[model samples]
Target: MPTATRVVCEQLAPTIADLAGNQRLVLETIARDVADGADIVVLPELATSGYVFESAEEARSVALRRDDPFFARVAELLTGTDAVAIFGFCEQSDGDELYNSAAVVTATGVVEVYRKVHLWDRETLVFTPGSAAPPVVDTAHGRVGVMVCYDLEFPEMPRSVALAGADLIAVPTNWPFTDVPAGERAPEVIHAQSSARANGVFIACCDRAGIERGQHWTEGTVIVDQFGWPIDRASGVARATADVFLHLARDKSISPHNDLLADRRPDVYPKGAAR
Candidate 1:
């Protein structure tokens, strides 16, 4: 088990429809985080291609294939380090379909790609929803799970990954700003906190900043501990950093008499509930 893993979530403002510039921004961000000793770095959803597209054709224009050399450049940045980078991208599948996906990358290359299962608002109009479940990849740092924005809002999504033995859940989100009461956190951040506490796993949600196509974002990048408290949160466009023992998440015991996972009454619960 690893001792303490340094995790970073960067809140970047990506320009809409500028694939080259967005890719450059991603590379520079990763390089800087790696130099700063970030074991795991996460970026917002659609980091490669900005969200809020006017049309599907517009999105397809900036979509990248899994084998795009741009990913190689990202891997090159981690050449001698054990660092891992997970970010969202507009993916062009082998077929005519386009999906909102998150890729987990290391020095070796892309390890796993998880397409967004839950699309929010206009996203359904532009991309096809993924059929597969979230994936947990074992890395030198720890077991990292990948999920895109809206997926994290679903309780089952996080629980399934936790049951699969994920130490940290990395979420790449482009959350649109919405109304929140005074002295309260964004609803999205609340969801992250709830999910983390319920599953007893660390969750890092990387959210984007700035307005795109007149749509303001929540800029709610947060790192939550297993106890469901916010470890760190990004203000405006910045990075939230935290050093935590990834192995600690393996223990699901909340109290001496209660174990989060072991105490589940799956047999009596609804059939569609997370097992």
Candidate 2:
């Protein structure tokens, strides 16, 4: 039997520091993707707030509770839709701590809030590291997990999610100019592919584009298949769909090269050592 199909819309755009405008863009894009037959829509990191901010105060000004009026509006728009959405925003958790968080919202409400664990440079001074890893939540779409920008670069992050039985990993990132060797693929693009292929799970990576406050963002939004191959163009900023057989790949153990979870020998590998 053919597997269930899922479409992930990679919205590549720079979000200015406007709460209403950002929320509107997110809602409109989600609506379009759902209408276009997307089972899940992934928006760029910092979709709700501009990534390059002058100060933490500036970032905090736009931060909102998950149940804020803006997100409540998002919930209303998602009502009765089968698709789920993952987007980034500054989350105002209880106390004075602010977290760089991603929200996995379904028809009911916000299902999971994934605070970025690994901080990138100045991000450490602003947002605190998330104490716990985001749990892979079971949805009608599939076993889905969420990760922020820097988290996708580390193999341990996605490996944990895959070990928890996540069929799809939704990543939202604001990648800037880098000097890493991307080979045929750009660095950010190759990183996403590597992350997906390593975990033997589908990757939907949505990235922020355009020059924001002097930082050049590499807007290489891509959707990767089981073998770390791009099913669509690498540099295009459009919605693309890939038909993936998650159960077949998982149950049949059809991961390419068996690198991450597929061929790990945990019995001999020491804790904190590379496998």
Candidate 3:
């Protein structure tokens, strides 16, 4: 029998550079969702520091060191809880470079920091690109893989994590409104769904809402099943928040005769090719 894990995606409209207020929101959300029986809670990219930087200088001003007291506060509060939080923020590394990063804070302490591998739009100018693969951590729910915003668009990111034995993928993003033609599923939603099915793992996407620095956001957050379908949400429309069970990700058998992961033909797959 597979164990079930409840996961929640929190969509927030965070004020840019308001680290104190944003930190409050994160802690509060974790408490609320934990009471609601969530085993895993995910927040939007740069949830504490916020997004939309005019320049590298502005981004650096809001970066948090790996040993900042912020994580200590989170660890202090999580001492007796089973919930784990994965959130995005600006990381001020020892090398003096700012990277768009996400951290996993458990009851014990901060376990992992995943730097964003794929930069988006103007982010390339303000943040250093991370060269490491996404980190997969063992949680009570299952092995959780972490990624940020633009990283999910590239199949390689999540696929690499799943291949590394992740039961679920958590993506914290600031999804801006892109021009999707009439009657089309938004690109972000499609990417989440497709990746979940392709990797045969559940996906929890936490996104930001409202405008940031004169730019509008799509605000379409969703939780996808391992088979690539959105879970039934009470909102009856696209919602910024939703919950799903982790055990669903444990099922990789497309049919009784074959398993999705076992069916891969990696031997013949090209290692690298020109796009």
Candidate 4:
């Protein structure tokens, strides 16, 4: 009775400084997910090159152009699959500066690029910040929005897109392991859950896992619904996939009760900030 959207979520252990190997893995994963009946496939952040690059020079060396041969190869694989592939890659721009960027690759072509807006510690030294927020785009599945690693931590990013009419938020992350007591409910995951519940939207957080350059990363990739509940979860570095029906459980009888966006008293809140 519920019309759910099917997506294949992939968790890959990307090898640092190995563009060719990464490309092969991405293509293989795409193929596997497509065969499994995925309407969409989301990969980890900086997927093409592992997240442990030592310097801007290091990141630049492995970064790929939008028109690179590898992207063309990916586009070729996307043909006839009818699945939109969203994945992260280090982008090389005009001045050759690098960006932590994600692209939504449809069967037709690349739809949009959502660059990392909020940079992490080492990332600030390497990549430039994106000034504008990414708007949600209408897709066959629904209205979807994209955000990179650190962007998911900020409420404004998701709030803005949700307010703009996004029904789903696709996040690509590479979270590091910490001693936080929440277990799988890390701050990043909490942020995703809260944002989803507050905005009345679904969230798909695809993260990188395993030891990268000797540092442990969090492997808690999940798909949460409007009630801020996870429908699917991954444990200890493996691939997990699921099909979610948007608006399945949500009915008109359930109105915006704890919704943060709807409850905001913008008149007073915005005035103080404007001053």
Candidate 5:
């Protein structure tokens, strides 16, 4: 049988300084997705703490260390279920450094983490830049990689993980409105499509919305299939909810004699060529 996995993307409006409320929403979303038979659940970046901080002091107030009890609570939400939740948060390392990060949690344990490598404006003032590339994990669902908002903008970000054999890339993003051509989807959504098509991998992007501290966001949450098309529901509409099932192992071949991953031209490419 071709391997199949169910992916869920949630678009939530988080309030600044309301950790309790944000926790409730994420827990409830995961419970709902689990009950619906989803294998992987993704929440937007900064889901634990709202984005847009006035200063590093404010960000530090909400940043959390890995040993923080908050993760234990998040892991408990998946107990007795085979579901995995991927969500972003403000991280405070033991060394007193902060990072914009995301974590993978299962009922049994916390799997892995991906700190945002590409920091947007103002984020540099608060969170420290992650020095490593994205990571791919082995799971029952498949090899899944984690990414946060701005990192998706660079092609190498996803390509590196895809080369490592990622079947799906779960991105937790806070996409703000940007100018796009008329009659076109959000540029970020288009980038997601391009990333999947170029690498022949599925991508599930969960984006947050609503204005926070005067910063507005675009709710462009989407689950793209391995063919880089938006997954559709049984009702023939775009699967725009938290219960969509996806078949990640299908259609990785581009043509009768061509494979998306097998056919590469790295020899002719320069190592430090401009992107």
Candidate 6:
């Protein structure tokens, strides 16, 4: 029998520009989740710096380097466990660039940092777009893929990581509340389900709750299984958690003849638009 991985997505409400407060919240949340036997804890995008920045300078003010001692602190919380925590932060590069990035932290340290490739509305004005591909890190629980908010909107982004043998993809998002039809699910949740089903991989999206800068959030934190159905969902400062067999994601067969990854016809697809 395959061992199930306990995945938890904390729907936190981070205060905008309150770096110190947000950091405290993240630490406290991680500690509580760790104690609760969470194998993998995921937090919302910009959990450290918060979203809705007033200026690039403001965002830069809370940006942290990969080697920041804060990560070491996070690692300490998981010192004796095989737990992993994935969360978003404002990343300060060596140069003048600041990136909307996510960090994969474990008992050892910060293992991988993936900068958000697709910047949303106002994000492009404040942060530089990442040129590197999203990462798939081998974690104690499973093979985890990391990406920030807007990156999950693009089909190619999820497909890229899924092709890289990721068992689960962690998405930290701060989804602005959008009006939806009655009895309908949020578009973001639908995207997650579609992505998970198409790639045959589990997806855990951690979304922030509460209003920030007069902007309300969707608080659409969800954990979807390999078959694309939502296993759990979080509401207002709560968490969505589920135990799943991560190894099952390795199987891509939807039908007896069709294999999700193996059936791709890359050669037939267009690389770029024709002039």
**Residue-by-residue lDDT tens digits, candidate 3, 22-140:** 88988888777777777888888998888988788888888899899999888777778867889999999998899999999988889999999899998989889998999999987
User: Candidate 4 lDDT, tens digit per residue, 111-227?
Assistant: 787788899988999898877687576777777889987898777788788878787888888888766864446778888888888788888889887788897887878888877
lDDT of 1 by residue, 67-90 (tens): 999999999999999999999999
The root-mean-square deviation over C-alpha atoms between each candidate and the true structure, in angstroms, is 1.1, 2.6, 2.4, 2.4, 3.1, 1.5
Off by over 4 Å in 5: 232-251
Evaluation by TM-score, superior candidate among 1 and 5: 1
Clashing pairs in 6: none
TM-score per candidate, in order?
Answer: 0.98, 0.90, 0.93, 0.91, 0.92, 0.98
Which window of 10 residues has the lowest lDDT sum in candidate 5?
233-242
Q: Model 6: residues >4 Å from true position, as ranges?
A: 273-275
Which is better, 1 or 2, measured by TM-score?
Answer: 1
lDDT of 1 at 206: 98
Give one digit per residue, the lDDT tens place, for model 6 in 41-61: 999999999899999999999
Candidate achieving the largest lDDT:
1
In candidate 2, position 50 carries an lDDT of 76
Q: Write the per-residue lDDT of candidate 2 for residues 154-218, one digit (tens) a residue.
A: 87888888889888888888888666555555676787787777777888778776777788876
lDDT score of residue 232 within candidate 1: 96
Error of 4 at 157 (Å): 0.7
lDDT of 6 at 270: 83
The pairs that clash in candidate 5 are none
> Model 5: what TM-score?
0.92
**TM-score winner, 5 or 6:** 6
Task: Give candidate 4 regions above 4 Å deviation.
Answer: 182-184, 247-253, 256-262, 271-275
